[model samples]
Target chain A: MDVTLAREWMRAAAGAIAADADLLTRLDAAIGDGDHGVNLNRGFTAVVAALEKTPPETVADVLIKAGTTLMSRVGGASGPIYGSALRAAGKALPPAAEVQPADLVAALHAGLEAVRKLGGAAPGDKTMVDAYGPAADAFEQAVAGGADLAGAAGAAARAAAAGAEATVPLQARKGRASYLGERSIGHQDPGATSTALIFQALADVS
Target chain B: MKKFINDPADVVAQSLAGLAAAHPELRVDTEEQYIVRADAPRAGKVGLVSGGGSGHEPLHGGFVGPGMLDAAVPGEVFTSPVPDQILAATKAVDGGAGVVHVVKNYTGDVMNFQLAAELAADEGISVETVLVDDDVAVEDSTWTAGRRGTGATLLVEKIAGARAEEGGKLAEVAAIGREVNAASGSFAYALTSGTTPAAGRPGFELPADEIEAGVGIHGEPGRRREKLRPAKELVRSALDAILDAKTFTGPVLLLVNGLGGTPLIELYLIYGEASAYLEERGVAIARQLVGNYVTSLDMAGMSLTLCQATDEMIRLWDAPVRTPGLRWGA
Candidate 1:
């Protein structure tokens, strides 16, 4: 919820996508085409590049610019979904003010909604929504349970990781993997795993 | 691996640049994401546009020449080009008569292209579309995600382009597109994994001794994986899968497409196997195409497409076509 902490999460998200490219690619090979890791890496790399080129004046501006950069550069469903998420999160924020726990919850809720809308996918779709939805809920619930910003992000990251791991048992209902039917089972969703990493990276950042 | 690319991110962009440089006969809008013939629309002829993902070279790009497609849109590797890109290409190729879209029936491709059609209509462009779902890999896959739409795309583009260039209306061109969709079926097998530039690795893991049957063009493995079989048996299996339902079908157009990485000799070997099987079944191969009309990155495999053509269909198939990937017209 802290503005400093939330911005750090974005940076860490970029770093996380970069760091685990091979693992993500391996995950993708099992289910979808083995390009998610690299596709997202390139996209987030562009986001980092844009951020470096023009440091935003406000926290919200930072999120919006990063989101737009990813959308413009990322090629697949991940592009629009992640892009809209960041943009929505950015819009939910006050112009140049610090963010509180409630503010962070509100922003992430908007981001999750944007991702759901753009992807036309929902929970149990064996998509990033699986990780993101549970993560957001866990974060809010943890905060309600009297956790602080980092504490909430940590809970969110754990929930996201568990949700991503759980996708191995469920059949995919979205993306190219869905066409594989029962074969899509037993393979961890590359998108959901990468999403879990985003939250994990946020926890690491804190 | 032998490809001349700096990074996966720059492969498509760099390839587009090289394509533009090599072919001055086409006007390339890299930013808008289209390749249009230099003299497009040709005053009264209906426009033809077809595109899908990249990696399948000489497809949309190489096919953008006279007597073929008026415009070709290129998407990122294995991903369908978005609506804005297709719309931009559509407007650029419209000949005042009308425009016909030849779309492969992947859910994403269909959705995006249809959205583009709607966008074009809002801009006052009359666009007719044909959805090709010719791959017999799965039935009602994903509750009518439809067939995978592989292999037969080449036939559709060529035949429909000829009909359009010969003053056929948009509806007629679209009709030919639908006819191919109805009459054609394709089945592919993969002996090796394909490499996507960004991943810097094969798209899937196949055991050294395994072959994947019913694999799609996008390296999505296949319906079943079994021990690798002999070239002849492979062809027999592929043919049986395609021709099992047809009962002495009418005139058929045959295409033996190599799935990249497969040499001409192997393709011919598979063709020999497929041709002999057709001969035994008393199915006349009215027109036969061999070699790679479609490919899956670097996957070592081949798909066979059979289009049971009527007299009208045969006429369209024999029509002249001039494109980098397929050129018969002078």
Candidate 2:
């Protein structure tokens, strides 16, 4: 991935989040606090503005800047969770302007680890981790199978979407929705849905 | 949705502006959205800081004053403060002595405060955190985040803030705060759900004859919804939930807190019922506070908080306090 692609990926994610903002919020209202869509939209908008104002040089710089912006702007668990994930992924990348697909796979693993570390969510906890974990795994597998950036991004995005859908029947085991106990079942996890959108944004840009 | 708000997006900022206008003793940083006592960071005193979502009025922000929080960080409505805001509040309140952060036990608040504490440590500031998880509505289990911090947050801030003001060390202040949290239990029920400015509608719906029992401050679902009962029965149910969790031996500090839409008359009535119920059980009430100290915006409900107070806690509770939402001896 290069700097331009990284910037495009963020722009795509912002557009997707804005487009699905209401849907995400409604989903959250069912089980969580009902602010997930609005919060993520606000954060991504700020990320776009920050990137446009003072552009970063390397792919890693782009991700790091976007992550820092989200951390500062998004005032919720998503801020620290998503923000640290992006920052850790950026840190895991090579310091050069461009990185190989294998390096991107490693960075994806790093981002997933960061999400797990911060939220203490494992797979099937019905959080963003559910989507993020599968997406990272799919991307790594695609890369190992000699898929190019576009092919790997497509695989990861599809995996994330499936992961989000799989949360519908599972009761939340973490975050605000966990407070609902059995009532949280049958609702799509908002955080996981948004994570899917973000991965789709990457695939679209790729 | 009929709030006196010009723009939903600006509720937090506008409210902070109003708070600053009303209380000149507070230094409200509109840009960073934090409130600090004008005389914060006293030369030899440990600073006390606490904060959460902005919808809970007079909570962390209103309680910022001489005998309360030295700094308060208010996030978006029902949202946790970002790490940057928390880090700034910590730095602003850090005296030569350490700082104590009294954090509510929500997932977002806990994670954000922990991140800020780590950042503050990297900057050479010593910080201690006291997590308040006193709400008994949500069961404490591995399947959930844990019991949420609710009305007892006010107790922790007041008691711990008093300790900090009395020149206690950071550890002492945090320990006192933790003790208060451990000794306290809260239960709430909502007649109606609160509307967030951005949502422009009630978070949840309640029928005319029904109530959301054990509702959270942010209108999160509670234990169950049940038919509305008389004030006495409601109070008894709340007490039963609390007493089931922990038994209070000594005189208790009782707080009948409204959820913004509740009036003083209703709160006093609930308090009276609670006082009578506890009196029947021979539980002594040493101190009591009533009103909308911590609230969800326009949610017509109330919560009862009982703190098993020690002699030192009672002494500190009677100490001077001057702030926007609460003031007495001073």
Candidate 3:
């Protein structure tokens, strides 16, 4: 995948988040401040607008711009987490016009690491890290197994979706939902769900 | 749904515009959604800045004045303000003495303010932060992501603002803020949930015969829902919880804060009940304030805050303050 595909992935992710905005918010309302969907939607919409207004020529440039836009537009813990994720991923990539499937794997790993570091949440914390962490691992494994870029993306998406669904039984250990203690167990994490949606978008666009 | 708003999205901006029009003493930056004292950047004095989401009226914004916050950064309802806005406000209000950030201990607010502090330090501005976590409700809550900062935020802001106004150093003001927070405890109960403009619905629906006890300002689930009782019973329960958390023996400042939508008459009634309960417990209520100060958005409820007042705190609390929501001997 190249810079153009990266843009398409972002666009597809934006569309997916927009389509499921209310659902995400409803999930948040169950155990959060009830604005996750609104915040993410606003940030991604601004990112889309920014991308259209000043289209980046390189993969690194596209991702760096997207990260900064998310940092500014999305207010809350998720903003910094996702912003750092994208920025770390972008920084991991060399300034090249195109990126290989292996580069994508490295970028996902960096992004997941950034998210975990910034959010102070690990895989079982019932945060976006839960989904994105597994997705990164799955993508790297698929790439190592010599799967093509699209095949690896599909694998990552499936892993992320399953990871998100798997959050239902785990008690929240981080973020606002953690405040609920055991009560937060039944609800799927909104951030994890959104993460799954983002990977699904990447697969669809690929 | 019947709110007198042009659009849900515009509620905060429009309300800020109205505040600007009504109070010339305060300067409102509509674009950034921050309010600063007209005479800000008071040289040789510690600058105080505090803010949170917009729905809580007379809180960070309403408390901005001579004896309180120098600037207030407001975000969307129930959301923490972003780093840029906070960084801007910190810079705008900074004097040579440095700035004190009065932050509630919610995850978003803490993270964003910490980010701003880092940015400010890079620019050579010394910053001190005081995190308020005084609510005796749940140890953690949906909005807080930790022990929720409830009514004591106002008390801390006011006391710290007074210290800042008195030419206290950044460390001194921040220390006083922390002292206030540590010395205070709060509890709230809601008859109904607050309605966010965007949601167009109440945060939660409590039955008319039931009350949400030990609730936070943002309508997070409290200890439990129980059958509604008389004002005295509710006040007793709230006071008992607060006393259990932090036992106060001497003179204490009592704040009966009306979460918006509660009538002044009811607040007075609640205050009377709360004060009477304190009297029965042999705790002296030294200073008191009753009104819609720190509030949830149109949530029918009230919170009780008790701060163990020092002689210095009382003197500072009595100091002049001029703002839209609070005013005295100006």
Candidate 4:
């Protein structure tokens, strides 16, 4: 993947977040704060604007800039979580302008690690980590099976959607939804849904 | 939905503008979205700064004045303030005696404040953080990553702010704030959900006769939904929750807080019920405060916070305080 593909992924993610913002908020209302969609929308919108103003030259540069923009622009729990993911992913890009499939796998692994670190959430916590974790594993599996970056991205997207769907039966063990205990079990986790969107956006762009 | 707002997107910014217009003693930084006492950075005095979402009106903002917060940062409605705004507030208020951040225990607020503290320290300023997590509704909730900091926030601010104003060291003031939090407990019930401006709707829908008991300041679901009971019953239930958490002996501070939409008359009725219950139980209500101190935006509810007060706490509570929402002695 090149810088152009990386930038396209971000743009697509922003568009996707904007399109499904209300759905995300409604999901959050059932379990967490009703601002996930709005907050993520605001952050991604800022990311797009920042990219438009000063487009980066490398995949690592684009990811770092996008991460920084999200952290400063989004003032919610999602901000730092997503921001840390992108920044950590950017750091894994191996000092190259173009990202190979192996590089992409490493990037996803780093991103997942960052989310887990920042949120203190494990896979069964019904957080964004649930979707991101599965997506990263799928991406790594696809690359190991000799797939291209686009093929890996498609696999990640499908895995993320499945992971998001899997959250419906979970009792939240972390974040704000943990307060609801058993009540949070029936609702799909909003962060997981949004993470699926991010992976899907990557597939669409890649 | 019938709110006095120009645009949902501009709610926080415009509200800060309105606050700046209404209170000259408080300085509002529209660009940074922080409020500071006009004469802040008092030499040799420890600075007190606290903040959270915009909907919790009198809370961080209204408390920014003499004998209270030196600065308060407001985020978007029901959202935690960004680190930049918090950093600015800390820098603006820091005197030679250092700064103490009174942070609520919500995940976003705690993380943002922690980031700001690291940044502030990098800029050569000393910072201390005191987490207020006194809500007894649940051990953890959706609005909180841990037990929430609720009505007791007001008590911590007033008591700690006074100690800071008296030239106490940052550690000393923070210790007092922690002690106050340790002795305090809160329980709230929501009659209506807080309406999000962007959505123009409440997160939860309740029938006329029902309410969410043990609700958080945000629109998070409470312990259980039940039929709206009489004031005496509700007050007694709230007090029982607190008493179950920690028994208060001797003098105590009772704050009957309105969650924005409740009227003063109704608050007093709740207060009367609570006061009578505590008195009958032989718990002295030494310091009483009633009104919208910590609130969820237009949520028709009330929270009761009781702090077991020591003589020092009572003296600090009665100290001179001048702010937009609270004033005494001075």
Candidate 5:
């Protein structure tokens, strides 16, 4: 993706987060402290403002800048987790202004790895990793199959949505939701849901 | 929901402004959202820092002063401080000696503090972290995040702070904090859920005759919900949970802490019941603190923390501490 496409992806993600903030909050209320939606909304809004104030030169720089802004402003677990993911992804990308679909796939894998490292959450742990891991894998597979950016992004978005939905029946084993044990079941994980929204934003922009 | 606040979003900032206005000994950075001792970075002395969500007031912030934490980083209400803020606090409090971070064991708090410590290390500041996970309510196993750090956090901060003030090195301070956390256990029951400023409603609802046992400081649901019992019975249950988790042979330090909305009168009543039960169980209460030292905002509940006190710990506990939330023998 180019820098312009990267900026559009971030803008779309912010818009999606703002629109679905209440839904995310309600999902979190079931098992967590109920601030995921609001926290993400605040962070992404700042990301939009920051990008507008000083637009980055490369796609990697745009992602890194957005990540740093979220890290500073989000004030919760999501900020650091999502921010670290984006930063790691940006760092993984080529320094060139534009990147191939395969490069984006590798960057997505790096982002997913960052999330797993920061949270210590496995795929089945009912965290953002659940959605992110599947999305990254799907994107990589799509790119390997000679798919274009739009086709690969669409595949990743669909995988993320399915992965998020899969969290509804599983018990949480990490984060605040883990405090509920069995009660954490039967509710969609807010982090996974938000991750799905972010991946969908990528697809939308692509 | 009915809190005395100008706006829900501004609650943390406004309260910090008020704290800065009231406590001249504290240097509150409203923008950075950290509070430090006025004369921080005491050369040749280990710097002690502790922090978490803003709702738990008097915790890291109120305990920042002489013989306590050198700095406290506050995040948004019921949220962990960002890494940049934590790194700033760590750097600000780093005397020539190293700095010790006393972190509560929530996933968010631990991750943020760990990130900050790495940042500090990159900047050439020596840093150590002691995690507090003493609550007996959550099951301590691989399946979960482990028992949450609750009332015992106050004990860790106080005893560790005392050691740091006495010129103990960073390792020693962190070791002492870890020891306090290991030797302590806590249990809490909530009469009502806390209302975060952003939410503007109780996090959860409890039937009038029921209570949330093993409730977390952030209003996270506990082990189970049961019908409310008499003060004596409730205290007995809480004590049973803690005492069962760990063995305390010698005299202990008892902290009967009120969760923000609780009154002193009710807390004292809980204390009376707790002490009598402990006395019956032949557990001596050598030192005691009864007040809202650590709290969940507007949560009507109480948590009991008991530290198996050794001579050194007792001596440190008795040391002079001058701060807004706690002041004695200054």
Candidate 6:
């Protein structure tokens, strides 16, 4: 895959957020600041704009540029975390015009590690990591098992969705929900849902 | 429900137009959705970008002028702006020396800004991010999302932006922002939930005789709801919450702010109480800022932002600043 193809993935994610603004907003209302849809929409809209201005020649270039735009432009933790993820992923990628399934795994790993570093939190913390980490793992395992790129991406998306759903009962350790203490329990993790939405977008592109 | 808006969705966009029109010195991009300094893309200077949900008059947006923010992204009321607007702002502000993002610690706000920075980096614009988690109302144990980035965000924006404008590089600016967030704390008491124009009703209902402590700007419910106390008692409670935070033990810069609905007299009263309360604890006030710098929309409430000060902080606080709402040098 190239920059164009990856942005196609981003466009799909944008559509999901726009289509499910209510769902995303409701999820955020429960355990966040109630602006996931709006924020995501803003970030991805910037991504599209960047793409329109000058498309990246390499996959790494595309990912890094997209990540930076999100971090610089977006004004939330998600902006930095997701931005770092893509930048991390881009750094791990080879200077190739096209990407492979194995490349995708490396990208995911870099993205995950960047998030952990930036947020200073770990798994089971009721964050998007609940969804993103699992999908990254699942994608890596599938790719290592010799699964096709599209198939592994699809499996990753499914795993991510399931992981996001599983966050419903978790006590939040990140974001404003962390302020609610016990009140944060039983609410779905908005970050996880958005993470799942991201993987689902990847599947759409695949 | 009455607002001077053409449409709820277009409120931020149109208001940005008004911002540009009102101040020709600042470059407002209606298409890109940014309020950048007129001298923006300042060659080789580290750029500073700060934003949050709109409706907080003179906040992130109004604070964008010569000495503060290089650019400000305006989001919808109580909503984080989409990344595209942020990316545009970052690019517009980036003058080849990279950019720094000052993000409040709300989940959506943090996440979206991070994503924008990533996109910018891919385009070869180096980006660094610093999170502001200065609210003292939330418990600081490992189980929390950390602290809410409340009123102290104004302090960070002003100080960090000044440092960035003073030729501090991206890394240095980011470090100072983190340092500020570590040293600052805030707490808010809402006499009434904010009235959102789109929702028409209040964010939440507090009985006429009650107030909510630790209420955030976006209308999220606070830590506790209680019967309305006198201004002194309420200010004391707010001061205690902040003083009790892990990062608030040294000399401090105090920000006593009124929610949009509060009268100026009431704000002054709250400020007096806060000053006395802080002085009682031997917390020397290095600098004092009193006004409606950050606000919830039409909410009858106030917040106390206390930044534990270092000499560097005091110097930055006194730096020249110019904006539509705040001007020290003009």
In order, candidate lDDTs are: 0.81, 0.91, 0.86, 0.90, 0.91, 0.81
Task: Supply DockQ values for each candidate.
Answer: 0.29, 0.73, 0.47, 0.56, 0.71, 0.26
Estimate the overall C-alpha local distance difference test score of candidate 6: 0.81
The C-alpha stretches of model 3 lying farther than 4 A from their native spots are B140-144
User: Model 6 Cα displacement at B145 (Å)?
Assistant: 4.9
TM-score of chain A of each: 0.95, 0.99, 0.98, 0.98, 0.99, 0.96
The true-versus-predicted C-alpha distance at residue B175 of model 5, in Å, is: 1.3
TM-score of each: 0.87, 0.98, 0.96, 0.98, 0.98, 0.73
Candidate 1 residue lDDT tens string, B120-191? 999888999988878877655443355777888888888888888888888888898888778888888999
lDDT of 4 by residue, B1-330 (tens): 899889999999888888999998788899988999999888888999999877898898999999999999988888888889999999999887899999998878887888889999999999999999999987744433678899999999999999998889989999999999999999999999888897677879999999999888888788789999998999999999999888798599999999998999999999889989999989998999999989998999999999999999999999999999899889
What does candidate 2's lDDT look like per residue over B133-208, in tens digits? 9989888986568888999999999999899998999889999999999999999989988888877777788889
Highest DockQ scorer: 2
lDDT score for residue B57 of model 3: 89
Interface RMSD over true interface Cα atoms for each candidate: 2.8, 1.2, 3.1, 2.6, 1.2, 4.1
Off by over 4 Å in 5: none
For each candidate, what is chain B's TM-score? Answer: 0.96, 0.99, 0.97, 0.97, 0.99, 0.96
Task: Give the winner by DockQ: 1 or 2.
Answer: 2
Model 1 Cα interface RMS deviation (Å): 2.8
- Clash number for every model? 0, 0, 0, 2, 0, 56
Candidate 5, residues B110-136, lDDT tens digits: the string is 888988999999998899999999989
Question: What docking tier does model 6 reach?
Answer: acceptable
For residues B209-322, could you state the per-residue lDDT of candidate 3 as single tens digits? 998787776655566778999999989999998898887995999999999989999999999999989999999999999999998888888999999999998998898887
How would the candidate models be sorted by lDDT, starting from the highest? Answer: 2, 5, 4, 3, 1, 6
Compute the lDDT of residue B277 as modeled in candidate 3: 91
For model 4, what is the alpha-carbon lDDT of residue B62? 92
